[model samples]
Target chain A: MRRNRALLILLAVAFGAAFLKAGSFPGVAAFVPAPATHIAATTAHVESRFASSKLHTQVHAASAIELKDGTVRAFWFSGSREGAADVTIHSAVFDPQLGRWGKETVVASRESTQHGLHRYVSKVGNPVPARTADGRLWLYYVTVSLGGWAGSSITAISSDDEGLSWSAPRRLITSPFANISTLVKGAPFLYADGTLGLPVYHESFSKFAELLRLDRHGTVIDKQRLAAGGQGSLQPVLLVQDAQRATVLTRYSGSEAPRRARTMSTQDGGQHWSAPVASALPNPDAALSAVVLADGRWLAALNNQQAGRDSLSLMLSADQGASWRVVQVLEDQRGQAAACEPRIDAALRQSDLAVAHAAPEVYAGYRDSARVKVQSGGACNFEFSYPYLIQTRAGDFHLLYTWNRVFIKHLHFDTAWIEQRLREAAP
Target chain B: MMAYTDLTGLAGVAFALGVMLSRLPLISRFAVARSWLVAGIMALALLPVSDLSLAGYVRGVSGDLSVTSLLLLGLTLLSRAHPQRQGLLLLVAGAALALYPAAMGLGSFDPYRLGYGGYAALAALLLLALWHWVRGNGLIVLGLALAVSAWALGGYESANLWDYLIDPWVAIHALFALGRAGLAALKRRGGAR
Candidate 1:
């Protein structure tokens, strides 16, 4: 009886604790946010600039935010090459008035990351920087201590003075399976309650996207899967329609043919999501970004090709995300544009004059910096991928993406310009 | 916030490294090998390898050691008590097959994501531990109880219940041990024949 009593006590304590651990922390209903009701100064505008100057040999995955003074700060990872030891996260300020980008400087490196985290960091990449509701700038990037991208985790650091200085980096506990395989790509958005919803994805045993709801301090409070399984989606780009309605566009990685971009929407403020359905836009398994227009439409920058990322365009979706139509050919490197470089020495001019005009000297420098990355299967490739889009309070769309895996091209267009393009696409 | 994570890493590395050092011939010759092993464990935790401790580097790659893993490593430390090896091996092997391959994106359900929402899996664990406890399997019962209690206290960095229960290393070792046991059983039958 005594032995049985002791066993019962142990079991009771553990069971009681387990019941309490069921942590049904009264599902906090999604706070209804006051609709974003700011109409910016409607000036027709469109311009292009390279946010990253001759700072690093290779650069990719650029995300940007408009500062308080209206200058744009863009962040991208650069190094001798991707995954190289010298790889570091760098940023630049885009002074729209001057029509030029400030000098690029390294923000986070492997050394700084390991030092701040107090752990061994093998590499870091894919910076997703955003302004929190409380006016601080938070940068969430990918970190790996072992293996490839499959063994990745998300690390976050914040700057109170808008990218002037940073707090020590802390690893976000995203997964239970050794906290491995959570990566950031899409833009993080703010909740009505000053919390944040960071869109992340799993690349380990699966290729599904997840939404991690974090408190103000960056602690993950909840996670909701946008899709499931390897056949699901990756790199989600979110757009909010209202307090309870939101949509997510993802890179389709399905086994089936007729590969279209996958999309899902949440009706209950993201407590759950409808199954991912196929969108009309073709997805060649690449990353993309979207922003909500002042007029309530959504615009996305993506490589619209079925095979290569050689063609990038802006697609407008007037019906939330049900349909999409290309309003502008942001980049077209097909046909003659995909010509082999003439003798490696002659200045490599882009087929698109806009890109050529944006950076005549960029092509000359890219050959030496990212020679190996641009060469695919012994062919010279024109590439544009990993688009990051943000709409400033002044109703300007700032789109940034990798230019030939060497430069981060920032495209600035205003709401008036977007309206014109949308009107032209109208039937 | 990181102390619990670091402490768990330290304990795990101590047990694993201590057992490994105890196997050295020079150390094994001594009657007080364990004492020396304990001292060595402390040094390994504090001993910096490129500024971070050896244990910290291991933790960086491995993340937190699951309760099951720590318990298994501790078992290797204590002198032989192998009464429940078959049952534990079977459980580990079965869980690895169920959780890993599917969680790798093969199955419809991630089962791993079930870690964050709540501890619905704990009830089943309670039943399993109870049966094991009735059968006098203190090691398995204690491991399960401790895992639940630790997770309940919310000290772990991960909110997932599965994280506390099993990790990749423990699962892989369990499969290897089970496979070895099967081969040994086959050899015994062949010898009998």
Candidate 2:
């Protein structure tokens, strides 16, 4: 009996020690590397546009790509509110030289998706378009049939005429269980062999990121879960370092305070991934975009503030992603010089909301209240979030994000502009 | 387009149905009938009926039961010979209680997350299987050994280790069986008094 008692006590100690060792979190510095010395020219020519119709009730999850003709085409979903049946995918094109956005047009509607898919689409969200190596534009968007966002499934449509027209939509077979709960957000990574790596996430039964490896024909051939079993990470944005290596930054979704973004990397292509680790950067639980610049510098546009979407900052990293420094404050609740400019023109023949049949008094009241708040040093928490960044062949950075949830704002800048901002901010 | 992983789960369900029917005294009279019935159910589950496959129907109802639940069903069916019924029920009950609450986010720690090659849960399961082996309960030990091997060979759709260990179905069933056992024990004590 005494021998058995001793064995039990020893086993208890061993189990306790094992539990303690399992609970420790991985350190961030081990995953983050050292900084590099030089970077690309930071000067930039800045341009902003309200790509969506200013009269729309709400707009979000905007994505863009530069066509072969050098025209910047962007798309986002808009309606009375998100998840509304009447919501439709709205798109617009910007001429870089003219610096003006054309009229927004309805590209993909709920009825059109239903006709193409042969199933009922309750609503649509997160439309991401990527131009393949052969100049074919592949647009992937999310459709919900049964439940909330967790019931989302991705559908693919191609544009041969560069956003002018599209092919019939086909659902990507991502999951065997009715192909539900998979959604795409980050830009697709186009490989040399015409294969595409789309970063998607599952929100049903599990909140984890997955990399869907698709054939050139948009068929899902393989899938690898990123940060599998980790609860708080999703919407992974890929930043390629080489042909076989890349870094994925995921948005943390858990209810933990002081939310920070999650990070993972792939070395042997997308077959295997390092376990996700918390990054040093603070996340306000909002979507952010990252891109590897021509000179190998990393650029990210994110809500730098810890707990609010009111401030969006463009940040640059020299040595991979080991460290990040704020390059420019794109928008902040405190103020942007552009925000102070008069919103209502002197010739007030009509208001932007008038086209939507919205109450002008209510619209004007909200607008006046916002203006008063800004002028009184109490700027309303107008959100500038869900940034999507892409680099054109000319090496210019094109960024699109939501503006106060009212319009999809596009910002164009150059590497020289980023360098100048970093220089000025440096002591 | 149904994948092979989705179709294979029905084999366990068909086998379970056969085992349940064979346990009845009237059905057990014909020995060969049980094997034939199990084979027929498995064949039907693999085929399409009225445009909908049997696997599709089962997936619709169960939403893809975990590999663990399927293994548990197999062990329960086989354990009638070895008769470690109480031990197996308690083991399943413990796993279910440990996993479901954390999976539902009742705590900060999720054992479901551990289903993804989690070391602690794997170690605990290994120890439990070893205990069953020492007690000469080969059915459950065989189940655990096969589950681990299937996980290593990528037998299931999900790469998660927890998916092969415990799911909500097995957890709920185990908890109910344990509750019933507790009630029976209390009744026996009252009758003796």
Candidate 3:
């Protein structure tokens, strides 16, 4: 009888506990915070490594554009790294009206024995496709023939029918290796006289940004250095307002303290530039991108953190690359608590103090959950880096950034969203 | 706060009841009963308010299994044998797996990010434990506890060897519960026979 009473008490306790647990279900609903009120204005789609054929792997350094009939076209390189024997240029188009990316087509590969040189070319890098001022669509990309990224040459293929077909790839012969200077980050600026200003960069032992001028018939007339010296800067993005005055934002590659962003200005139609100055931004020695806003502002995508790439930030500069105000934080992964304690415990068990010291650095670098910095009024200290921005005709900003090297995140927002937030802050 | 409040209340009640029940010799007598108690403990650990219950929190800290899912799955299948075979297979597989990161000079890719969110880590760990249990090593019970403790602590960088050895996954808990329940059902039927 006494045992039965004890059993009854135990049953009562279990029932009571389960009742309370089930009652707590409402609490689970409260943990999820409210979603963002404004939707992103710009939409970004990733053209991953194998958007085309599986037979040939290795795809990187991509550029895209949205055509007049709402067709989005993208171009990239495929082969075996930067200097393998099987490198080739590939292109794809996205028909937005039909809501599908077109079939992947090969644009250029190694020339046949009848048409070209004997040595095997390994890979290609950095493809730039643009519509010229005369309505001719031009595709300019690099092919590496001999060495690493240093022994690369730029070539062009034109399509008069908006990429349905293309002319044979022709070597530009832009550099000293008879066409072997790395010509990348090509953005065409249409001069008042209908000429083209191509922003190119060299990446031998001395990495420098240069501006090349070409006639309408794809003839290279002249060129000049935008920023010189071996600061390891490449990808000079040009923002030209008129024929004479322009600004070029170059990605910093040097590994020194207070990492600088090289910038220059042309006052004489791609003739001369002011000495490149390091901007007040921290770069962990990686490539960066920038684009001009329609309102005459500049948007830069880069790693804002001093040491790691965990924080990718997007900044808007009213003055050309001088000072930047962070518009948004794309990714900010904080560390987890559950996994940290036992790792510390294991370190203690092993009595390895050295490994323990390095553990925190490893934890900080690998933690995937990131926080977006939204609180305003002070200079944005949050990390927002490696940004690529494109402004649409509908006045929306489309931005894409590498989210901790795990995935690429696309952020789209409009001027109205910024204006609305600013108006709300005025009170 | 209410979610946390409910979670703490439920956990406190369950823990207090478990402690009280465990004091009674009758409840502790049977292995099947003890296994049920373990299931209850796992459910308690999953309270929404607990740090281990968050999806992104776990994945970021624990890593993902997407890249090595096939390999882990294969190991899971191989370990489901008799106790001696299970132990041997686990040792061989564990040694190979542990050395793979170092040998390839490949840094730890967070496997927690790979699969469906929320229960991925729990599932992977449980599957691993099930493989151990089927081999009848009986060390799976201890492993389950260690794994849960490691996961609860957020698997952070500390001076502890236990963190690297165990991981909390749903499959581990479910497998333990299922295996114990299956054994209990078999014994009951056999007694009748």
> Who wins the lDDT comparison?
1
DockQ of each: 0.48, 0.12, 0.01
lDDT of 3: 0.49
Off by over 4 Å in 1: A1-34, A68-70, A97-100, A131-136, A191-195, A337-379, A424-427, B1-4, B24-27, B117-119, B127-136, B186-193
Instruction: Quote each prediction's TM-score.
Output: 0.87, 0.61, 0.49
- Distance (Å) between predicted and true CA of A79, model 2? 0.5
TM-score of 2: 0.61
Residue lDDT tens for model 2, A1-427? 4544444444445444433433432211111121232444554667565667555367889998888888889989888778989888888998887877888888888777765654456788899997665778989999887778887888788999998999987666455334467888898877656567789887877687777766566655455667664467888999877766779998888767678888988786555678888776678878889988766788999988678787789998888788999998887654434434253221111223232244777556545533443344544346678999988767777899987667677778887787788889998
Best first by TM-score, ranked:
1, 2, 3
DockQ of 3: 0.01
lDDT of 2 by residue, B1-193 (tens): 3344544545555555555656677766776755575566566665666444555455433444555566565554555433665566677678777765544334344454455444667687669766765566655665566566555554555544555555556667778977998999999999999
Instruction: Encode model 3's per-residue lDDT on B52-167: one tens digit a residue.
Output: 33221222222221112212332333434334433433443453344333211122221211211123444555555555545444443334434344324323221112223322
Question: Which of the numbered candidates is closest to the native, going by highest TM-score?
Answer: 1
Q: lDDT (CA) for every model shown?
A: 0.77, 0.68, 0.49
